[model samples]
Target: MPELPEVEYTARQLRALIVGAAIQEAHVFWTRTIGYPDWHDFCAEIVGRRIEGVRRRGKFLLLDLSGDFFLSIHRRMSGNLLLLSPGWQIDTSLRETDNAAWQTRGPTFLPPTATDVAYSRETSHCRVCFDLADGRRLLYTDPRKFGRMELWPCFSEAEALHGLGPEPLEDAFTVEHFAEELAKRKTVIKQVLLDQSVVAGVGNIYADEALFYAHIHPLRRANSLNASEIDALREGIISVLALGIEHGGTSFSDYRDLAGKAGNNFDHVRVFQQDGKPCVRCGTLIERRVIAQRSTHFCPTCQQLIAE
Candidate 1:
């Protein structure tokens, strides 16, 4: 699954290319991609609306439209967004084109072959496409089909986003906030960090990395931490997340940047997938275990199980 950093990267890339572009046409190849408002309503409502801006909240991408409507996309796993022009020739041999075409063409238009703008699937799993008036199209490709795209009124409340905990990178998520959230949970520290309601945007990869950085065991109870331990954990979480974003996110599986480029953060990971490798700090062998039904990687010698 593309976590916060990957989603944030995708949003940033989309914001740069799609903002101010009007939707000339809209197509929903997979009806299931739009979770709400029905497929017909989604197409009817989003067509002809200009993209005002693009933003991200947690793992959701929001494309603000001209009116009180926004396009929301959740790339659950194996999902990506690609921007292409009329001349774009997708390698249908390598990738499956879920849907393709121009939404609106200006008087002076570029030929499909001469446009020199192409967003190829490069792989067989391309799934959703959103055509814009500026001759550019936003495509959503997901091999597993676990992703979703939805349209809603601008005034619509994000019920799904409301209960999520504070963004770890925001000023609102201070050490005090982290401590408070942790104090309220009696679950294992790893489990608490993984809880979207406890702190949004954190996943197993980052949880493991943060715990390793803080020298906290995955099984440690959340409420057992002292003020100092809480502080360490807070810093660790922020540092790891910032690094992940700076490095374009980790690409352990099918995750890639908005342009379908691979991320480089996996090379910088300290312990997430380094099972049996030597720990960079203490020279101890990194270990992997199952916690909360997720694979966890850490150094047993570095992240002692003792409650701090």
Candidate 2:
């Protein structure tokens, strides 16, 4: 899933690319991708609307359109918003022909394979297509079909974000707020952090990295955290998320930006996917365990759990 930083970076790039562009046409290859109103209504309503702004709330991308409409998109698991240039073309022939001549011709002459040709095709599960007035095309591709696109009035933005917690990067989300919320939860700290109502936009990856940074074991009960531990966790969450944005978001798999480029944050990760590697802070080997059915990674020597 594309978490906060990924969605934030994508929103920023997309804002730069399509802010003033109007939608000439809306095509729904998969009807289920429409989360609000009928698909027919969605298509009719979206046409001719200019994209005024692009922003993110948690992991949801909000496209402010003309006439006070907001298009909310959630890339649940394998969804990606891809932008195709005005005159883009796919050379399907490259995959069909032998292409041995090009192979030996040089690296610059190498053509895209059949896989590349079909990456953004309808056959590749491109659910929705938006043809912009500028001649650019925006595609919503979701292999799992779990992503959602909904159209609603701008006045309903509060309702749309009602259940989500405060944006961690916002000034309203102080350490006091986080500590107060933790006081009521008896669940493990990792699980509490995963709760959207407690901390929006924090998925498994950030939770693991934050906990590891705070030297708090994933299994520690939320209410057991002391003042210093709470402060450290708060700092860790903000630090990692800011770093993620700086690197354009982490891409372990499936996640990519508008240009189909992967983020480099995975290279700087301390323990999210480094289970067998030695800890960066300590020499002890990192370990992975399943907690709340999500993979949890930590250095045993640095993040020992205290019995409460």
Candidate 3:
């Protein structure tokens, strides 16, 4: 899934490129992923609208359009948005072209050998595509079919986003509020961090990283956090999220920037996916376990659970 950092990177980059651009064409390759009025009506409502702005709330990409309407796109898991520049050649091997071009995966690296070229030319997994008047095409690609797109009249009218928590990167996510939300449940700290209603956009990767940074074990109950521990956790969340954006979002899998380039944040991760490695600070062997049915990595020596 493209979490806060990855989705944030895409949202921030596309805002400058797509804002003010008219949607020359709107096409959906998979109707199952369209969480809107209807496929036919959605095209009718969005084709000519000018994109007023682009912003991100949690993991959702909000595209503000003219006529007070918006298109909310959730990248979900394994989904990415790629912008194709004018004169850019899509893969020639693709034949299912329509209003949206059936969005083939734009070539990542130029194929070197004969075997690689044949495979690169037939890239699929593009679920939607929007052609801008400037001749640029914005393609939404998802291999796992987990992402979704919704067309709405406005934010106030969208019922799906009624329960999102505060953005951790925002100033409004203070330590006091963090403690209050923590008290709302007595679950383990890792699950609390993963809960969208407690704090938006802190997924499995960041949850482990943040817990490690705060020196709090993932299995520790939320209410067990001391005042100092809560403060450290708050700082850890912000620090990791901000640093993630700076590093261009972690791309351990299908995540890519506007240009289909992999992010460098994965290289800078402290405990995420660095299992069986030495902890950066304590030099203890990092470990991995399953929490909330998700793989978690941390420094067992640094992040110790308190006996409750």
Candidate 4:
């Protein structure tokens, strides 16, 4: 999953590259990826529209068009918004036959073999590709077929964007707010962190990192947290998320930036995916277990449940 930092970084990059650019056409290879207004109506409304701005709500990317419409993208798991410049081909296999130099390269598109299942562009899982007026192509790739694209008439509180929680990076998400939200839940702290309504865009990666940093066991009940623990959690969430954005987001898995580049945050994560590795803080072996049916990682010694 792209999570908050990845989506935020992609939005910022999109704002710089495509804002004010007009869409000449849209080519959606997969119909299921379209979530609203029907594919026919969607393509009709999107073509010729100039992009106004790009923003992110939760994990969804919103492209504000010149008209009242804006496109929202949810990169469910393995989804990526990659750009293909005028002469660039995502599959570098073409480079093998041509003498043209590869101007820029970030991530590979087509797989190495047919058994890899990236068969062809028309049959490939690159769900949506938009032809921009500037001769650039915006590609939406998802091997798992979990990416979603929808055209909204307007940004309505009662419409498609409903049920979203406050962005942790925003100034409005104060320590009091995070603590209050935690106070209302009796589930394990890890589950509370994973809840999108509690705080939007947090997933398994940051949840584990935050809990590890706060020294709170992932299995600890949310309501069992004391004031100091809650305060520590609040700081942990904010600080970790801010650092993730600074590092351009974690890319240990399918995530890649606008240019198909892997982010450097994966190297900075202290707990998530570091299971069986020695903890940097206390040299304790980090452990991984399931909490709330999600893979949870932590340092058993540092994140002691006895605090409750």
Candidate 5:
């Protein structure tokens, strides 16, 4: 799944490529990808509009159009967005085609493949395509079909987007705010951070990484923390999220950047998927367990669970 960083990267890429382009047409291959207004309304309303800008709120990508409308996309699991010229052709079988390709020519060619080609003007797994006036195309593709594409007059009407916590990267999401939010939750610390309403844009990968960084066990109750622990957690959450953005996010599975390229952050991961591997800090073996039904990885030596 493409987490916050991955989704943010996609929005940034789209801003650079498609912001000024006018929508010549729109193609919706999968109707279910749009959550509201139905498929017919989406096509009629979005076409002929020019893209004003692209912005990301939490994990959702918002494309500001010429009028009051916006196109929102959520790449839930395997969703990706790719921008390409008319001549671009994606070969999904390239992994088998060249073993050294990613190592040698990988940087140049991979980001596009990480892009969602599910929707295109030509052949694609693209669920939606926005044809630009310049003959360029922006495509959204998700193989798992869990991704979503919707058109809205304003972002507030997208019920799922409303009431999300402040973005961790934003200037408004202060340590004091995070501390207050945690104070209100009696749930496990991990669960509190994972709650979008508590602090938006955090998911399994970042939640595990943040807990590992704070040296707080994933099962520790949210209200159990002292001021010092809360401070540490606040810093940990911001730092981990910042690092993930810097590294283009962790790409253990389907997560990729705007160009459809894989991210290298997986190599820098501390404990998320390093179970059974030696901890980088203390050489203790990393462990994995189910926390809130999600596979969580951490260092038992470093992160000790607080007793109830």
Candidate 6:
């Protein structure tokens, strides 16, 4: 899943590319990708509307369109939004996948040969394509089919986001508020951080990185965190997320910017997938364990668990 920083960077790049671009038409290859108003209605309503602004809430990319409509996209697992420059046309032959499309195992749902051509030409998972008035085409590609697109008249009407927690990078997510939220849960701190209702936009990657930086074990009970630990945890979350945005995003797999480029943040990760490697802060080898059904990486020496 593309978490907060990935979505935020995507929104910023999209805002710069398509804020004033008008939607001339839409080509829906997969109807299930539309979350609201049915595919037909969604396509009908979105045409002719100029994108006024682009922003993000949690992991959802939001676009303010003409006539007060809002467009929201959630890249659940392996979705990416690609924007192609003018003079580019879809190659019809690229739409057909090889017979071994499903037999091969890879990071993206796209065929193994997908890397040979420009991203825009690969239509294996291009679920939705939008033709802009300026001749550029925006493609929403999702190999796993877990992503979704919703068109709402207003931001509040999107029921999918009704219960999300506050954005961690926003002023509303303070240490006091984070501690208060943690106090209400007895589960492990990592699970609490992953809970969308506790702090929006944080997923497995950021959660692991935050715990490593805060010197807290993922197995530690949420309520066991003291004031200083809580403060450190809050700062850890903010700093790691900011750094992720600074590097574009963590592209361990699948994730790509509008230009089909991978993010550079993966080089800066401390413990997300650093299992068996020596810890950056200490020489002890980092370990990986499954907590709350997610792969968690941490340093045993640096992040010892409290007996509580």
Query: Candidate 4 residues 1-308, lDDT tens each?
Result: 88888899999999999998899999766677898979988899899999999999888899998878888999999788877666434554534654233212212454445543322332234677788899787888877777899998785524888877898888777778888888899889999998988888898899999888899999999988999999898789888988999999999866778776789999999998898999999999999988899988999999998855
RMSD of each: 5.3, 6.4, 4.3, 6.7, 7.0, 3.9
Where is model 6 more than 4 Å wrong at Cα?
91-117, 120-123, 155-160
Query: Ten residues in a row with the worst lDDT in model 2?
Result: 102-111
Worst 10 residues of 1 by lDDT: 101-110
lDDT of 5 at 269: 85
- Candidate 2 regions exceeding 4 Å error are 88-123
lDDT of 1: 0.77
- Candidate 1 lDDT over residue span 1-308, tens digit each: 87788888888887887788888876555567778789888888888888898988777888888887777788886777766665443333221322232111101112265323332333235555666766666677666678888777766746635777888889878888788888888888999998887778888889999998899999999999989889898889889988998999899766767666788999999998899999999999999999999999999999898835
Clashes of 3: 0
lDDT of 5 by residue, 49-138 (tens): 988989988888888888788888888887777776664543445446764442222212122343434423223356666677887767
- For all predicted structures, in order, the TM-scores are 0.88, 0.89, 0.89, 0.87, 0.86, 0.91
Q: Measured by C-alpha RMSD in angstroms, how accurate is candidate 6?
A: 3.9
State in Å the error of residue 213, model 2: 0.8
**What TM-score number comes out for model 1?**
0.88
Cα shift from native, residue 50, model 3 (Å) = 0.6
- As a TM-score, model 2 comes out at 0.89
Tell me the tens digit of each residue's lDDT in model 6 across 92-147.
44235642442221113222344435663434477788999998888888888889
Task: Rate residue 202 of model 5 by lDDT.
Answer: 92
Q: What ranges in model 3 sit over 4 Å off?
A: 88-123, 155-158
Q: Pairs clashing in candidate 3?
A: none
lDDT against true structure, model 2: 0.85
